[model samples]
Target chain A: MSIRDLARHLDISIGTVSRALNGKSDVNPETRERVLAAAKKLGYVPNQSGRSLRQGTTNTIGFMIESTIETADNGGSFFMPVFEGVQSVFRRHHLDLVALLCGTDEDPSAYLNRVVGRRFVDGLIISATTRNDPRITFLLDRKIPFVALGRSATGGAYPWIDLDFEGVAATAVTRLVNFGHNRIAIGVPASDINLGYVFQDGYKHALAANGIPFDPALVLPAHSNEEGGYQVASAMLAQKHMPTAVILVNENMAIGLYRRFYEAGIHPGRDIAVIGFRESTQSRFLSPTLTCFRISLRDLGIKLAEALLSTMPAFRNNYPQERVELIWPMELVPGESDVLKRTA
Target chain B: MSIRDLARHLDISIGTVSRALNGKSDVNPETRERVLAAAKKLGYVPNQSGRSLRQGTTNTIGFMIESTIETADNGGSFFMPVFEGVQSVFRRHHLDLVALLCGTDEDPSAYLNRVVGRRFVDGLIISATTRNDPRITFLLDRKIPFVALGRSATGGAYPWIDLDFEGVAATAVTRLVNFGHNRIAIGVPASDINLGYVFQDGYKHALAANGIPFDPALVLPAHSNEEGGYQVASAMLAQKHMPTAVILVNENMAIGLYRRFYEAGIHPGRDIAVIGFRESTQSRFLSPTLTCFRISLRDLGIKLAEALLSTMPAFRNNYPQERVELIWPMELVPGESDVLKRTA
Candidate 1:
């Protein structure tokens, strides 16, 4: 069956039927549903490959996320809101968004090459960017329209919208210092992901600004999850001079830290001061509620979509000169986790 | 750049090069990396569409998931492990898995139709099955190779592998009854998802089996997320008689329930017994650790992949007579939350 037959069967105008099938906003909801039902019933399989080749577009955008153990443990909470925001923007333009999940064992660059070569999506939004990401270089070499969700030190000058990890670290350190914390420790990600580097740099600079001597021993590296937090607390307990305060790069880690502390009869707000990376439903409800940063993930997703669309030749006009290289800001939410005052 | 040229340039046999490109296990990891790197550097764009059409297969699998707020809140933690398991199986067969995320506002059936029509994937794995799912009917009508991650009341025999919600409800109720609790309650999904119906039915049957009258007021329907759990707690508090024990279908809700109970100066294990549906990283770390069920999601994913493959013509022989209609089991892990005995 074809579009013509489908429209005739539904007793709707061809334009209305086409518009409904294309997911155009102008069509009435009832009319769209009716058209879709008729099209499906009549087996109207659109010549997707032929049409895509002819029109030079598939009208689909792919958001690539890696489903690593670390990501599965926490990234879902981060990506879902962002996806909703991105979808909100794409819907108006009759675009469909699909998540291209990279398996833990697969090489991301090779996966990108295969997907890009297939020409399945008009553009891509790649997350979990590492230092000098090869995917960025590959995308640039192929002249593919794309946006990186995290900043990379790669050679290409492409659009990226990263969470202000440096700012978060700096702000957190400043707060701890003002609270009379001279001996402070930070839990950094052990992975080569660029955020860890940025966070460490920010922490170092903030310590320097406070006129405090940098102690390499205070910087603990661990997996960016609850286990990591537990490890950080363990390391602090083992320290010759325990830090008066500790800052964690991953909020999920707070749970583990709290558990470890509780086992040793230590209370977060009463015995030690703690600060987490971001606020989440889980973090908000933690006993002695976690002090963390908050960002509108949905708004960030909208910006990400706009930034990607601006790079694509077809939709560049809609977002004129809107080439974004943003460091999305996070606001601190004070809670009971960091209320301790240091005793001299 | 063709495979022939690539083989010659790398001084590798053409068969080895082909095997490496196809992701065969026989090829050395270093050789595969060399082949992939050379292929990318030489700009060898595989004729994916042409090859797919000629072979009548795409060597790709699509797992359809909805990114609705309800799903976004808790589904991420659940799906990530499942995805890892699914990928583990698919990688062996050189099949790539992509998640087709249906937007919150979009109709699931319509999205399925579009993706199926595009011939993007050779097979599919659909999740979040409703009481009367249209996607199942559509897939069945098209004679597409697919598997449902949950069961539906829709007609036509199809493969499905769903969590044993009924068994869980019954088992929890029996345990609570044995603990001398007559006024037990259950929090179920407000949506018309099939699991809710199964859970409620199991609950009612269990209540009858325990010689206790089934009160409709005792059955609470919520959004299947943390906020929903809070609402359930509030509703129970407002009741004329509060339940001594309660069961939640979604483990994520336990967090909200714990928050609400803590605010009301109620201790879970001492005041009211609680049993959550599944064990998770967050739940395991909850204060007064949650009593819940455990299922290896990775193992479930592997089974799901095998079940779907059994339905496909090409892979049918590999898993003969494995047309799965499984009610996957969950083992109970007793914890501190449900140790209280009801007052005489």
Candidate 2:
């Protein structure tokens, strides 16, 4: 059955029948019901694009992720858990998730345009933010509903979920200091991402609070992986002024440092002290388990989903800058890696 | 607008309008044009459910995954990569992905029913297979197209992609033997998964191939995580007849073994040699650097997607005995963790 038959049978204009079926308020309620019932009976359905253009919703969320193999590998531990958490909430709400892997060389904006301009999803979840990120500005200018996974360094007006890096770093330092480690080194990612800066600030703050002068030479920044840790430790071991303890920002790198120290004929717990972030299942079983902070990526995902859902407008309008920052508390798991006797 | 409105505007019979929109052979050319013109002007669209029912296809793939924090963590590493790889292929083919996370407490069959009976997906990719898995039977009996990520022990016929655990294990053993380490212990997962068995077979085969008798006492099966590794290694250390070297199957467990060995006052490369499978970026920069095999999860994902697209008919058939198996080759990276001098 076609709309023409329903219109002829109802003795109304075809345009009137069309307007009623499309849920336009201009159509009379009684005529709209009759048209809907007739269309339902005839099994006539509208197309997604047409429905989206009319109703302004796709009931889908687009996630634009950097598809680089290297970043993806780190994200396995860093970003994926958060995604799983977000998915859990979406599943409960019966919402669909559309994932787009943006290549490092390709402008992510192009992909976002394809999804947003084409009316594919109602909201977005973005990760791996940089200072003055073009993607953030594009999403903001377009009035697209989105929540960032991390805070932007340039200070954007966006809702985000982040860890208290500075707080955690300071805690780690103080714990090591209380254990009588005067010469402490801070290891962080070499690149300038927001977390690196936060960690550095925390390290400095903790040193000042403890009356220990910050040594610029003791602050080592390397790539955020085991190789980075191994290289940093190798360089430190070669230096004349070696630290009694080390605070690494990355978890995988700390694992590398543990191995590096072992290779250099040094016992992690007995000789030198170490602390890092991210508590992997492997951290607990290391001969002298690693003392580190644990954060739930899944919780981060749930928060991002809630933020996205709450921020979406019924129609395009300027959204309020309600920067909802969900900061998860870091818990330290003490292990054999930091067994230095208290000197203070 | 409804289809009936388009038909009425064109002054054509509802049946003729329906036939033309659905691409039926009997519609006259002039009448088809009239119907097409009216549909274009009015924006009439057919319903998706009716079309799918008529065509016997939804053009979507279902991926059922176990929903545990540990499993989810592994999913980021093992599943997401493959999912992305498959997505790359599916995007070209104009297919969609429907992901389902199944809980351990909930019946897998019920979840399968909601997705399959509701006609949400055309095929499935089931991960973390076990012996006599009910999911395998449900998909097979329903004639649903699916490929298992891991091999099933029940001898159920199905296409699958798996890591060559036996081959890699044997390779690890021989490598250790070549380095003059005769007494080697093999670490397996304490879980009842089929991969653990495959690893055991490989470890024994390699030892036998090198003219060394297999020692059941040397076979250590623990949980497939870091703590499991620590407990198993601690046990091995306490043993009167300790192996000069150890080969671990899982990467998480290997990290634990590294720590346990150190705590036992043993140097990884000098006092005891170690080898592990599944090399991550973190493993490369370990103190002694870890010697192990690496499997690409991304490659596995791409293959699964190709399989899903090809086996649609067999999947829809009552009997799903046809099977495809793809084995990924593992490469060995030399590191100080293995005592190379022992074999010489």
Candidate 3:
């Protein structure tokens, strides 16, 4: 059954029924309650297409996820939990969440344009934002409401919630420096994503803050997997002056780094101190559990979704303005992975 | 810019424009060429929402993903690669793929009904099908074209592409049996999903085929993760008739199993042979490597999508019926995880 049918059955005009159903102040409260009771009793599920056409809103949000071979641990293990948090908040607002994925074969911008161009969603939650994201420009040009799950160098008034990469880097480096480690290596994504840039800047800032000389030779760009970790370890070992400790941007790569260390007969907690960015379930169980930062992915997702809604006209009243734009920080979880002191 | 605007600009009927765009036989080749050229020159992007309303199809497919705390490695590492395969095929047919995640607060069947009722997609690709999936009956009753990524016992003549769980189990069991082990323990999902049932059936069949008595005590149900693997390992060690060998269903859990073994000062390959089901990048890099089966996830996804298309009336001509139903097998990759003879 539709609103027109309900209106006809109640011997009322369609406009009156629409206003009553939408809870507008123009309608009588008793009449509105009566219309709602009749609609519910008739089992009339509102048709999204019909309503969205008239309202210019779908009551839905799009979360665009791009999958590359490197970060494709299903968009990095952080997505689902974050999605869970975002979904919870969306549900409170009677909004639906849909994820738009770019096929490996398709152009990312074109793929995004196809959905946004068609007004497939009212707003968007764009995850894993790169340094110069084209989607940001595309969305801005269209004036679509959106929030980025990660930081981007693309300057604009768009809402974004990124991990505190600088904090993580400084903490890892300072902690290492306290242990008297001058030669410290770092593993970051080879791509020029904003996180890598921030992570490097943090590393440099921490070294300078701690009176350690900056060395470009210590930076290792690798994929966010075990192979990248292994590659970084091998590369570090080959250096004329090997690093006594290493900081990994992504903890998933720690598995490979640990394996390579094991293969080289070097113990992490004793011989070479190892630190990782985020501690995951996998990272938690590693031999001498990876000492890393713990960011509540679900909370981040919740904040990300809230950030998007804050930009949208629909749900601005429920969320605060300042809370929408945030640099989400992660707390350090101490483990045995980076507890070593470099003794001469 | 839409088809109607393009037609108005060209002073032609909308049907002629549409037919030309879709490469229909009714349109003249030169007229079709002219329409395509003009459409491209004008940069007309078809409005999916508008077209869906008129055609009674959205030209979009929903891939439903459920995330629970236990199996939530974002539905494990298997989904994204398979989605890539599915998206690749869907792209060929000019279909958009969207991910539908069930929030922890929502009921699966109710959540599915909401999406389907709203006419959000033309068809669906439901992942992680349970033993008696309600979606099967729901889709069949609604007459919506859909496919399951894995098999279900819902019992209907619909398309499905499931892994060869029986083959993997039998191979693993027979291999372990050949290595002189009568007491073999197996870890399956605690959930009542079809894969778990089939995996257990295959284990039983393999045991019976090998002339070994089936002992109910040998079956261990655990969460499909590292902690689950650790739990299974701990339970195995405490048994009065401790298993000589153990087979893990999920390979991601290998990390936990290895850690537990190391903590217990028990050697996996020598003390108690351990075999994992799938060989993933994570499983491949374990200390001694995990002996598991390898299946091309991309190929599986391609088959799953193709199978769904065969059931879809719009794309029936592009795909054959025989390719719809499959019991895809995995190739055994030798690793040191399970390579020991029990000294009886």
Clashing pairs in 3: none
Candidate 2 chain A, which ten residues in sequence have the lowest lDDT sum? A314-323
Error of 2 at B251 (Å): 2.0
The DockQ of predicted model 2 stands at 0.15
Q: For model 1, how does the per-residue alpha-carbon lDDT over A267-335 read when each residue is reduced to its tens digit?
A: 898789999988887666677789999999889999999999999888888996857899999999999
Give each model's whole-structure lDDT.
Answer: 0.87, 0.72, 0.83
Stretches off by above 4 angstroms in model 3 are A1-46, A74-76, A341-344, B1-44, B74-76, B341-344
Candidate 3 reaches a DockQ of 0.46
The TM-scores of all predictions, comma-separated, are 0.89, 0.68, 0.89
DockQ preference between candidates 1 and 2, better one: 1
Note the DockQ of each predicted structure. Answer: 0.46, 0.15, 0.46
- Write candidate 3's Cα lDDT for B205-311 as tens digits: 99999999999988989888888889988888899988989998888677788888889988788788888887787666677788999998888888888888888
Interface RMSD measured for model 2: 7.6
Where does the lowest 10-residue lDDT sum fall in candidate 1 chain B? B45-54
Ranking by lDDT: 1, 3, 2
DockQ sort, best first: 3, 1, 2
Q: lDDT: which candidate is best?
A: 1
Which ten-residue region of model 1 chain A has the weakest summed lDDT?
Answer: A47-56
